[model samples]
Target: MLAGPAWPHSTPPDHGPDMTLDRIAQDLFSALRFYSRLPTPAPADAAELWAAPDMDRIAYAIPLAGAVMGLLGGAVLVLAAWAGLPEFLCATLAFTILVLASGAMHEDGLADTADGWGGGRDAEHRLMIMRDSRLGTFGVTALILSLLLRIGAVMALMAAFSPIQAAFALVAACAASRATGILMLRALPSARKDGASATFGQPSHKAALSCALMAAFIAALLLVPLFGLAAAVSGLALCIAVIYMMAGISRRMLGGQTGDVAGATQQISEIAFLLAVLILA
Candidate 1:
């Protein structure tokens, strides 16, 4: 293994070596492993990347990974459409594939955050509710609404545009949403002293900006060509607005953020993006 710095930190590992193609690939793999259910890079590559001093600096790679995921899931919708599946069926299947692909990671977060925020009277109670495995009324309601909204948005986008446009919308929304959620790490403190998110710690402002920029580029490319520059800009603006609102709610309610809050933020941002696409497309 290309050992150097410790597991997680803000700066790149202090190894005397320059950033190479190998390092980039490893960083991408780290992000995929951390964010998705997809198979990660080989163990050797993963170990090397994990050892990089500034592995946390690879935060920018997360949205790139999200784009890749969207591409894969979007392909499902495109293919299903071409196969003559009904728009509703295609949208449902495509959404299901997406949920499976991500192991429903973000959805899980959304459910937990909903249950906690809805049921808890205080921080301790909320955090305790969030950590519980059992689903409650709030969680079930959130999950149902989220699923129905996303699937309905997909169907609506398909109705408004070609299957290709729908696919692009999914990719743009998925990538941009995941990118926006990272804002919490830069904007707020950690709610818990230790947990999944706490393990990686916070990111630098510059690194966070880099991640947002990458996602913005991808989102614009996917959105503008189909709808126009106005659509892309407006859609992303709404996404940013939603992320900020979610961050404020999480900060005020929980005093900071946890992995669940971050995940829920992504879910909400995605819905916001799709709503914009539906309005503009």
Candidate 2:
């Protein structure tokens, strides 16, 4: 359907257009990498700011944005805990912040992927099922279960460990979950001809590996100083195991990867990270 990947790679012309920095910033925001040093303009009322040249760079940006947002959400949780907020409330607030920041993009992907895989009998059928916009029973169930598990795991960790540890766990889970998406994108072929995933799914392996390392380092920074280096090592091992499982599943189900599969990886990886933290912390 993509006609041998003939998508144009030319940079947009710089002449005669009255594009505002807001437009560029919106594009970068969607791309999700390289935060702008320029001042963000006054808020606009429309979503037009999100339009940008969809490409591999933007695909690459998604995880970076996810990692940053994960860190921010983690920071919020830590601050709330430090301020004496209840563990349940802190966990809820941190999860809510992540959902708000990412517009639930990964969650939607997870639901769609679950519906597709659970309902379909074959690779072609799975791909078609995932393309549908409507959520099936499996999708709904997967979404509920994943969210509940994540929240519950974080809450349990908070109860068992210090609030700071819980906060670090949240941050690590966020980053590791997104790193799963990057890993899958790097390892698998796109399942569709045209879609957001297709547009941003073809990032180089080197880029993905770099992002993964950065995420691991960030997680380590958050965990090692607080719980000792063993905690960080355990977290990294868990993240790697989760990614490996997702990779196998992706290959078996669709012969490669779909946008929904990538989403599923993120969701599953996040859950895995939280579970690991709960067990190891």
Candidate 2, residues 85-188, lDDT tens digits: the string is 88778878888887877777788888888888899999889888888889999999998998889888887877888766777777767766677776776666
Global lDDT of each candidate: 0.81, 0.69
Using alpha carbons, what is the TM-score of model 1?
A: 0.90
Per-model TM-score, in order, reads 0.90, 0.77
52 Cα displacement, candidate 2 (Å): 5.7
Candidate 2 — worst ten consecutive residues by lDDT sum? Answer: 1-10
Model 2 misplaced regions, further than 4 Å: 1-64, 75-86
Among all windows of 10 consecutive residues in model 1, the one with the lowest summed lDDT is 1-10
Model 2 gets an lDDT of 0.69
- lDDT score of model 1? 0.81
Which stretches of model 1 miss by more than 4 angstroms? 1-20, 45-55
The TM-score that candidate 2 achieves is 0.77
